[model samples]
Structure formats: C-alpha cells, structure tokens
Target chain A: MATRSRALLPISFVVLLFLLLYLGLYLNPRHESDDSPMIGKLAPEFDLPDLIATGDRFSRADLNGQVSLVNVWATWCPSCRAEHDVLMRLAATGEVPIFSINWTDRPDSGGSREAALLWLGRLGNPYQKTGDDGENIAGLEWAVTGAPETFLIDVEGRICNRITGPLNDRPVPNPENRQEVRNNVGNIMKTVRKMVAGEGKCLTQDS
Target chain B: MPYSRFMNGLIELNKGLRMMQKQLIKMVYLLLLLWAPLSAAAPIDSLIFETQLQEDRFKQLVQEIRCVKCQNTNIAGSNADLARDHRMKVYEMMKQGKSDDEIRHWFVVRYGDFVLYRPQIEARTWLLWGLPLLLIPVGAWLLLVQLRRQRVQATEEAPVVGALSESEQKKLDEVLK
Candidate 1:
C-alpha cells in the first residue's frame, strides 16, 4: 500500500504541474486592454506644424481648458482610414473637440505630409486642427505605437483614457454587424461624458 | 630512383596542401574578425547625444524597451517606424539628462510593464521569480525520499545471508558430503 501511494505521489505532482501549465496557456503574457499606463497622467507636450496649414502650428497648449480627443493617426495606416468616418460622425455630434496628430508622415514610409492634408480634405476634416508630426518627435512623446490610437484629455489637460486600436464600433469591416458597432461608440461617448463630469480618473475599456 | 622521386613529389604536394589549408584558415579567420564588429554594432540613428556615455545609455535604454509594434523585439533591434520613434525618444530623454530609472519609468507609464524587457520585481511577479527557488528544494526532497524508500525496499528484498532456509542448508550439506 505504501509503495502504491508513493508511486501515485509523483503522478499526482505531474498532474498538478500540467494543470498549472494549462492554466498558464490561457494567461496572456502580453497585456490586453488597460495596458497603456499613460492613463490618469498628464499628456505629453508637443508643438508641431499643422498638416493643412503649414504656416500655423499646433501645440499642447491648444488642448488646455477643453475636453478633447487627441487622435494619433497617419495616412499610411489603414486603421486610421477605418476610423475616419467614425471620427467624422463624432465630430458632427459637436460633443467634444477632436485634435489630431499626423504621426510619422515621412515619404519613405509611404506617408507624405501632403497626403495627410489630402485625406483630411477628402474625408471632410473632422479634426479641429491636425498636427503634422513628420519626424515623429511628438508621436514618441505620446508613446504612440501605431496610428488610430485616441487619447481622451480632460479639461485640465490630463489624459483620462487611451484607446489603442481603431475607434470603430465594429472591429470587423462588415457593415452587417451593426449591433457590435453601436456599443463601442456608445461606450466611448459614455466614458467621455463621465470624464467631463469629473466622475473618473481614467475610464478605460478594461477598467 | 623513379619510385623515390615519386615519393618526394607526393611529400611536396602534401606539404603544399597543408600550407594552403593553413593560409585559407587564416584568411577565413581574418574575414570573420572583420565581420564580427559590423554585425555587433547596431545602426546609429541621426540623433546624437551630448556625450559617449549618454549615447551608450540611449542605446542601452532602447534595447531595454520593447517595441509595441514588433512585440517580440526591442526598439533598438526593430526597424519599424514606431521603433525608430521610440529610439529617438530614448535619445531625446538621455540628452535631457534623465536618469535610467526616470526614462524607464516614462516608458512604463505610457506602455505598462510589457514595455520593459525586465519587469520590476513586485508583488505580481513574486511567483514568476520565486517558482524556481521553491521547486528546486521540493524536487530535491522528493528525490531524496524516493531514493531512501528504494534503498529500504532493496534491503528488505535481499536474502539474509547468515540465516539461510532449512531446505537450502540441507541441500548445501548434501553437496558438501
């Protein structure tokens, strides 16, 4: 009986190890949502040229004293294109000012400063002002990994939330998925309203 | 005489072959040495730091931070535009006299612990760092217990040499007679 029990002990230990390993398989090592630690912190400051009006400059000071969405985008990013219509719709609502940073619009990377202006011209210019971050100096400060990341800044210029992916209601391109599309935009709007009301520190999707 | 001459020719040929092989190896080694530094050196960006120390720190910092776009690669090693931007950010911060901790903190604030190659040892990471230490002793103890048990079992199963069975003794006596 003792030998039988002893033999079973190692097997049980192995089973436990496998169980833990199986659990680990479900644990995502990479952070999902709420990964941007920039939430609740002061937004990084930048001064950049306006994408449309090259003579004019867009700076961090412009975001002060207003609840705004600073969207990091570029002509090269397809996700940015995907979110442009949503941004236009949001702008039509006139709920909040949408500032844009044209991130990494260098010609070599299939991005041109002129192309950004052309996009805005064609897309109806949803942004109050578009900053041309040609050299990505401002983009780096904001820790922008890619285009179509939106940062919600409160009246006090503090970043309240960061949306990493495209700001579409439906992540999928299918127009038929109307239900999924409604929830995402509504959620963003609700969060923005909450931030404006000074109800939350950082109202992110996961949080 | 012709045989001896043939032997001498063969020996000369062997000597020539050995010399050529040595020279080839030497040339290969020299080429490898020349290529080594080029591969080791990361591409330097246009942004320059004030001092060599600052530049070195910038390089080290970029390598420490993970590129969000290229999830598997460090910003310094990635050629993605975002990685380039991150590298520039690190350089800019270093030039501004930011400490290593401060720069790392800046990235952590923006990108969470995932941005760091070496995550901070905190409450959340206790298991990640402590598992090996905990498992090693447990494994050793289990091995020791199993070995001791096996030793005891072996002793029990072995025949008692001095206290032989009566039938075995009778057989031995008959054989001796």
Candidate 2:
C-alpha cells in the first residue's frame, strides 16, 4: 500500500504539471480585450497631410463635437486589406464618420503614398479625411502599433474603445449553443450608440 | 622495410588529424571573437543623443519595452516599423528631459502593462510572481516524502538478521543439538 501510494505521488505531480501546461495554452499574457490604457483618455493629437487631396491637412481638432473612428491602416498590412470591406460597410451605414491614418508609407516599409491613394481609389474611399503618415509621425502620437487598429472617440474627443486587429464579421463558433458572436462592426456600432446616448464616460476619470 | 613504411604512414595520419583539430579550434575561437561585437551592435543608429548618459538610458528603455506587434521581442531587437516609431518616441521623450518613470508612464498609458518587458508587481500579476516561489517548497516536500517512503519500503522488504521463522528456528535447534 505504501509502495502504491509512493508510486502515485510522482504520477500526480506529473499530472499537475501537465494541467498547468494545458492551462497555459488558453492563457494570453497580453492585456485583456477592453484593458487598453488609452481608452477613456483624451485621444492623441495629430495633424497630417491628406492622402487624396494634396496640400490639405487632417487634424485631430476636426474630430471634436462628434462620435468618430480613427483607423490606422497601411498598404503594407494584409489585415488592413481584409478589414477594408467591413470598413466600407460601416461607412455605408453612416453611423459615424471615420478618419484614416496611412501609416509608414516611407521607404523603410516599402510603401508609397501613391500606392495608398490608388488603393483607396480602386476600393471605395470610406474615409472623411485620410492622413498620409509617411513618416509615422502621427502614428507615434496615436501610439499605433500596427495597421487595422481602430479607436472610437466620443463627442468630447476622448477615446472610448480601441479595437485591435482587423474588423472581422465571422461568427464565433459555439458547440453548445449556435448563437452568433457579435462581429467587430456590430460591436463598434453598439458602443457608438451608447456613446451617442451620452453614457460613455472615461473609466479612469471622475468626470 | 614494409613495417617501417606502415609506421611512418600512421604517424603522418596522426599529424594530419592534429592539424585538423587545431584548425577546428582556431575557427571556433574566431567565431567567439566575432559574436560579441555582432550582438552588441546597436539596432537603430539614426537617433543621436546630446550626451552618452541619455543614449544609455535610451538603450535601456528600448530593452525594457516590448514590441506589441512582435509580442516576443523588445523594440530594440525588432525591425518592425512600429518598433522604429516607438524608438523614435522614446528618443524624443528623453531629449525632452523626461525622467525614466515618466517615459515609462507615457508608454503604459498607451499600451498597458503588456508593453513592459518586466511587468510590475500588482494584483493581476501576483500569481505570475508567486507561483515559482510556491512551487519550489511544494516540489521539495514531495521529493523528500517520496524518498522517505522509498527507504521505509526498502527496510520492510529486506530480510532481518537473527530473525527466523518458527519452522526455521526448530530446524536450527535440531542442527545445533
């Protein structure tokens, strides 16, 4: 009996180690979905050259007094291409105006402003104003990590939510129940509606 | 004469093998000498700081900050455009004479704690910091308990000296008589 229990001890230890390793598969060490520190803070300021209309500037001041989305995108990013159609659909809804920042179109990333303009011209232009961030100056101010990241700004120009990755509409599969998962567009709209209703307050601030 | 020729061939072979071994050692040493400078070479050379201290701080800051796009590598080690922008931002802030804490705070406000390579000790990371400490003692105790149990079992299984069974004792007494 002692020998059996002794044998079981190492086996249990191995089982525990495996369980911990298995748990790690589901654990993301990165921040939680809604845990972006930029959320609820004043959106970063930027003044950039317009992509389509040369000699025109798109500034953060224009975002004041309205709910809007600031989308960071680049011709170099494949995910931006994937999310372009969803952005077009969102634009068609006219729920909110979107401002675009074309990031890293300079020589290092092998992207050019001309390519960005041609891309928008071919795909329908969904932006109210498109900022050409060839030097990524505006991108640094906005703390943009990569393209296809969208920020929702409230009426006061405070950032409400930051949606990382491409705007996806695929239904999340559920084996237990076949309920459709809310797509990125749907989620954005829901938040926009709430903000429009004057309920979007800064989580960090008392006001 | 044939035997002597064979002996000479063996000695030549031995000399050739030694020469190859020396060449291998020399190659390894050359690689070792080359590796340090290659790894220590700065990633970004565009930003020129006014002072050496400021430049050192910039180097330290980049290593501490994780590249969000790359996930695994720090901004210093990553060639991602975002990392470049981040490095520029850090350099700009350092030029502005912002303290290290303030610069770190600026990133934390934008990217969250995930941006930091060394996460602060907080409510969320308690388990991350404490788990290894907890596991060490638990693992040691389990090992000790197992070892003790194994010793006990070994003693029980082994035949004891001067302790015979009843039949064996009777046979022993008859032999003695």
Candidate 3:
C-alpha cells in the first residue's frame, strides 16, 4: 500500500504542472473586449486648467467650432519629435486647425512638462490650443496606447479618423507602405473638407 | 489467558495508523489545489519584468541604428505591432539566457541586419557603423552649403521686402495698437 501511494506522487505532480500551464495559456493577456477601442466611440471629454494660464481652464468647448485635428504627444515619445515637421506644415497650411493634448508628461516617468513646453517653443507650436493631460485622464477616455497619435474630428465634434504613430509627409525610398498612411490622411482631409463645405451630416447615421 | 486483551490492543493500533495515512492523503490533495492558482499568476510578474528590460534594451539598441520601417522614427517607437513583437521576442530570448550576440545573430539569420535595432560591427555593416565617424566632415560641408545658400537668398530677397508694404504692416500694427 505504501509503495502504491509513493507511485501516485509523481503522477500527481505531473497533473498539477500541466493544469497550471494550461491556466496560463487561458489567461493570456490580449484583447478582452469586442470594441476596437476607437471606432464607434465618442471622443473623450476633458476639462482641465490650462498649462499656460493660472485661473483659466481648457475644455471640450475649446475644441468646439469647426473641424479640428487632435494630436496626442509626449516628450518621452521619439516618434512625436519625428512628426514635428509634418505637424508644423499642417498648421502652416491652415487647411485645418490643429489642437494638442499632451499625455502623461509628468517628470517622474521621464516625461517633463518643462520639456514639452520647450519642445513646442523650439519646434514652433502647431496647435491652436494646448491642454496638459499630465495624469492621462484624457488618454484613458480616448483609449490611447502610445504617443504621436492624430485624430481627425468633424465640425460637429465626432471623430472621423485616427492615425497611429508618426506622420511623415517627406519622401521615402519605399513606396508600397507609404500608400497606407498617405491614403488614410488623404481620406481624412477630404472628409474634413466636405464637412466644412456643409454638404452632409458630420457623421453618418450608421457611423 | 490475556490473549483477548492483546488482540484488542493490536486492533486499536492498526486503526490509528490507518487514520494517520488518511490524513496524509488529504493534505496532499489540499496542496495540489493551492499550487494551481499560484503558479498561473507567476508568469505575469515574470513577463512584466521582461517587458521593462526590453524597453531599456530597445533604447540602448535604437540609438545605434536607423529604423527599417518608415524613414523617420527608430525601431523603438514605431507603433507597428511587428516592432512591438520583436522587442517582446528579444525579451523572451534574454530571459532564456541567450547572449546579446546570439540574439543579434538569430535576427541576422532571419530578417538580416536590417532587423537589428543596432546593426552589428561587421563587414556588411561597416559603412553603417562608419557613417557617424564620417558624418562630422560631411555635416560641416552641408552646413557651409546651407549657410552660403541662405546668405545668397537673403541678399536676393532683400528687395522683396516691399512684399510687406509699410501701409499693410501699419494697418496690422494698428489692430494690435
């Protein structure tokens, strides 16, 4: 009987180990929701004190009136710097007003508010209004995963497009991958122009 | 004869031994149940540490090389899921105790040196590594060219200053005034 119990010991351990391994596989961290975390959602609303003003506040109302582009960026994000020229050109063109929502710019995480301000000053501000989202309250609402994200919103405040990562208006040696970004940006601008022309609803009923 | 008493004592001892064995079996079963959930959560902490390590290594690597994807933005910050997965795979290899050279070699064997966040110091990558050393002279030459061009343009465009006539400037100034 003692020998029989000892024989069962190894078998029990093998069973236990396999169970844990399967559990880990089942618990694998990935998307747990059905939503795209972007499409079919209202743009995140925020009202925060302006970084540049003492008593004044910057809110969603600041984004009201006409279509706009919201660029979420940070000092720590290298791509944000890469897209600086493209944003400057977009602002310079004045085809659409660009707004900036600075995300997670606290100094403790290697992103400093001072650094963000200096970056804008040195690079030239492309944003009509800038809001400091130092704690990332706005980021959570927008489901932002990283920096250098640009969103195109219609005049009625509905998000029409989202471009992840940095924008490069400059030429590249490869043309194949370039089509994706170029096409997305082009479609967004075309839609924005149409919205401004008062041809249709800012958002389709199904959209 | 006291044989009856002896038989009773022997039977009692057997019962106690059986009870001890039953309790031991129960304890074993209990341990198995507890270990299952504990080990499942273990890998999450391990993976989180690996992710942090990957970020540190990525910064160290990208400073030494250009991004293969898009003309701008290094491999470190490209939002392409491929870049993110590559970083994670590097962490996984590191966790498995693979040396940095071995990891770089694995990438070179598959995607070639272009996949390397930092191109290795080899004959094929010699120019890539050598470019920064050669850049100082090249950059100076470019700067000189740009400054000279700017100086020429400034002189040429000086007469075009009337492009902003005083009356228009004064009118805009008056709005501020």
- Candidate structures ordered by DockQ, highest first: 1, 2, 3
TM-score for the A-chain in each candidate structure: 0.81, 0.76, 0.72
User: What lDDT tens digits, residue by residue, belong to model 3 across residues B94-174?
Assistant: 778776777666555433445555556878778878989899998899899979989999898875434668898899999
lDDT of 1 by residue, A167-188 (tens): 7654453556432443266667
lDDT of each: 0.81, 0.82, 0.67
Give the proportion of true interface contacts each model preserves, from 0 to 1: 0.95, 0.90, 0.00
How many residue pairs clash (N, CA or C atoms closer than 3 angstroms) in each of the candidate models, in the order given? 0, 0, 0
Better of 1 and 3 by lDDT: 1
Q: Tens digits of per-residue lDDT for model 3 on A1-207? A: 977997797899899999989987887444322123354345657786665556777677766667888899998889899888878877888998898888788865578778888898898999887788887766645645568778777655666656777876644324566434443444566677777888433655344
lDDT of 1 by residue, B1-177 (tens): 999999999999999999999999999999999888657646557875578887677778887999899898788877787787777777777777789999898888778898899987799999988999999999899899979989999998995668768999999999999
lDDT of 2 by residue, A100-192 (tens): 999887767877988898889999889999998899888777778777788888878898777777886554424353222223577567667
lDDT of 1: 0.81
Which numbered prediction scores highest in DockQ against the true structure?
Answer: 1
List clashing residue pairs in candidate 1: none
Candidate 1 reaches a DockQ of 0.57
Residue pairs in steric clash, candidate 2? Answer: none
Off by over 4 Å in 2: A1-35, A169-183, A194-207, B1-44, B121-177
Model 3 misplacement above 4 A = A1-35, A171-175, A178-187, A199-207, B1-177
TM of each candidate vs. truth = 0.70, 0.65, 0.43
